[model samples]
Target: MTTFTLEPQDNGRLQSLCGAFDEHLKLIEKEFNLNISRNNFTFTIKSNEENPKSHHEKLIQCAIKLIQDLYMETAPIKGKAKELELQNVHMALQERRMLSQVEPERAKSDVYSSVIKTKRGVIKPRGVNQVQYLHNILTHDISFGIGPAGTGKTFLAVAAAVEALERQEIRRVLLTRPAVEAGEKLGFLPGDLGQKIEPYLRPLYDALFEMLGFERVQKLMERNVIEIAPLAYMRGRTLNDSFIILDESQNTTVEQM
Candidate 1:
C-alpha cells in the first residue's frame, strides 16, 4: 500500500482536488487500476491485483504524481481554489504524458506566456506539443505546425494571426489551403472556383469567424483585408504586411508551394 497526506491542507483545496463525491479520485483510481481510500486529506493507494506486480511501484508513483499535480491546481488563484472538472483532470493527465520528454520549466513557461484571448474567451494549449507549437509560432516569422487533425494546428495559427492583427503588428490576415479532395473529387463539384475552394478552406474560415465573429470576418473579407487564397490564384499575388496562413500545405505541389 502507498499512502500520502496532502500538506497544509485547506478544506476548499482538498474538496477541489477530490471533487464532488470524490469523483476525481474515483477517476484516478479507475485510470490507474487501483483502489483509493481517503481519510480527510490523507489517501491510500493499492493495486487491484491480488498480488502487486513488479511495475506496480511505478504505477503508484504516477498516480501519486497526478494527485499531487491536481492538488497543486487547487491552489487559490485569486482567493478561491480552482474547481476541478473531469475535463481539466483529463487534460492535466494528457499534458503530463510528455513530462519525461519535455523540460517542465520551459513547458510551463511556454503554456502561460502564449495564452490566446479571442472573442470567445482565453485559449490555452492542452498538451506539450501544443505548447511548443504556439511558442514556435510566436517566436519565428515563418513557422509550420505539422500535426494530425484535431491537434489545434490551424486553431492556434488563427489565434496568433488574430492577435497580430489586433495588435497592428500585421496589416491583414490571409488564409489558404490547397484545394485537394480528400475523398470527393473536385471536377464533379458544382459552382465557380471560389465556391468550390470555399469548402476546402472552410476550417480556416470557421476558426476566423469564431475568433472575429461572422459580421466582422465578413467586413474584413469584403475589404480584401482577410483573403482566401486559392492555390492557382496566388502565383502573382504580392502580399506585404500580412499574416498569411497556408493551411494543409502538405497537399500543395512543390511548384505551388
Candidate 2:
C-alpha cells in the first residue's frame, strides 16, 4: 500500500470536523484497514491493502459526514458511534454503485448455501387435506386451490411453488392473474399488461417476500427467475418444471383458463 499526505487544510478541517471523539480515527482506520497518523494539523493515511483507494476515499468521506451530523457531545466513544459510522459510510457507497448488480448474485448464492432450515409462520405448510388436493393437481398437471379469500388458498399455492424451487423440483415460479377492473380496461391502465397487473400481483409477492426475503425476491425477479404477470402473457407457451399460480380464476374465460 502507498502513503498519502493530507495538507494542514484537509487535516485541520477533518480533525475539527471529527474532533468530538477520540475513537473516530480508529474507527475509520479499522473499517478501511488504513493507517491514520495525525499531529494537530497534518495527517497521513496509508491505503488499505484489500480495497482500492476509491473505496477508501469514499469511506473516509462517509465517516466524516457521520461524525459531523450524528455524533453526540455527551456520549463517550461507545461502540454505537463505530457502528453508525460504518453503516453510514457503507450505505452511501452502496447507493452510488449499481447496487443490484453487485448484491443479487451474492443473495442468490447465499440463499442456496443457507442451512438454517425451520418453519417461519408467514405461510403454513398445507394441511393433509389440502396437500392431497395439491397432489392430485400436481399429478394431473392442472389443479386449483379454490376457496374464499381469507383461507390459505393463494398463500399455500405460492408456498408449494417455493418448496418446489427449493427442492430443485422446478426451474421457475410463474404467477399470473386476470386484470379486469370494474371501470377501466387493461389497456387504459398506465403501463403494459405486466405493469397493469403488478398492483394485483403484490399480494402474491408479499407472501413470497415473507417466506423468502426482500433480497431473494428482488434477485429472482432480476434474473427472470420468478414472474408475476397478467394471465394474457401466459398464452402460446409451454411451461415445464415450474410452479404456475393463476389468481382470480373467476375473472378468466374458459378459453383463457
Candidate 3:
C-alpha cells in the first residue's frame, strides 16, 4: 500500500538515480525471486504473500538510500527527501531476508578460518566480562563458564585452544563430558563404548568439526593430536601441556565436578 513519486529534477540527477538503483534492484530481484514494475521514476511491487505489505515499504526505503548515496557522489546534495519505487525497495529487502537465515553457518565458516589464519585479532577480543573471566582463568588455572548458551564462552574457549595449538603452546587437545543420560534410562540402552558415549558427546564432536575442518579433525584424531573420550578415562592421567574442554558441566555430579 506504500507509494513513491520521483519529482521533477535535472535529467542528469534522475538518470544517475535510475542507473544506480537499476543493477542493485536486479540483484535484489534475482536473489529474492520477485518481480518489479516501474514507469519513468515510479515503482511498485506485486507479491502473493500476505506480509508483502511491510516488505513493500522497506524495499522503497532501500532504493532511496541507494539513490541518496549515488547523488552524494555525483553532486553534493544537502538534505533532500527522495521518493523510491516500492518494487525496487522490496527486491533489496527480500535479498536481505534470505541472507539473515544463512548468516550463522557463514559466521562459523568464517570463525574456522580465523582460527586457522591465526592473525592478530583473528580471535576476536573478548568483552570486558569475558576478558575479566579469562584473566582469572589464566591467574587461577581454573574457571567456570556459567550462565546461558550463545554467550560465546564455550566457543571462545575452543578458539583459544585452537590458537594455542597453532602457536605450539599445547602438545595436544582433549575434550570430554560426563556420561549423563538425557532422558532414556541407561540400563535400557544396548550399545558398547562408542554407542553409549556418542549420544552424550555428539555436541562436542560437532563443535570440534565446525572449528576444525573435517579432514584436519580426522587427521588430528589419527595422530592423537586431538582426543574425545569418556570422562572416566581421564582418571589417573596427568595432562602436562594440552588444551582440554569439559562440556556439559551442568550434567556432572558434585563428585564429577
State each model's CA lDDT, in order: 0.80, 0.58, 0.58
| TM-score list, all predictions | 0.64, 0.48, 0.48
Of candidates 3 and 2, the better by TM-score? 3
> What local lDDT score does residue 166 receive in model 2, on the 0 to 100 scale?
73
Candidate 1 local Cα displacement, residue 122, angstroms: 0.8
Judging by TM-score against the true structure, name the best candidate: 1
Misplaced by over 4 Å in model 1 are 1-101, 108-112
Q: What TM value does model 1 have?
A: 0.64
Order the numbered candidates by TM-score, best leading: 1, 3, 2
lDDT-best of 1 and 2:
1
Tens digits of per-residue lDDT, candidate 3, 1-257, equal: 33455555455655544556576456545544455556766655444356676665555554454344333333313333233344544543543354345555652342212222232223332333454444444445567787676666666666667777878888998988777754545556678765678776766666666667678889999998989887767878889898888876778778766
Q: After superposition, how far is residue 181 of candidate 3 from its true place, in Å?
A: 3.2
Output the better candidate (1/2) by TM-score.
1
TM-score of 2: 0.48
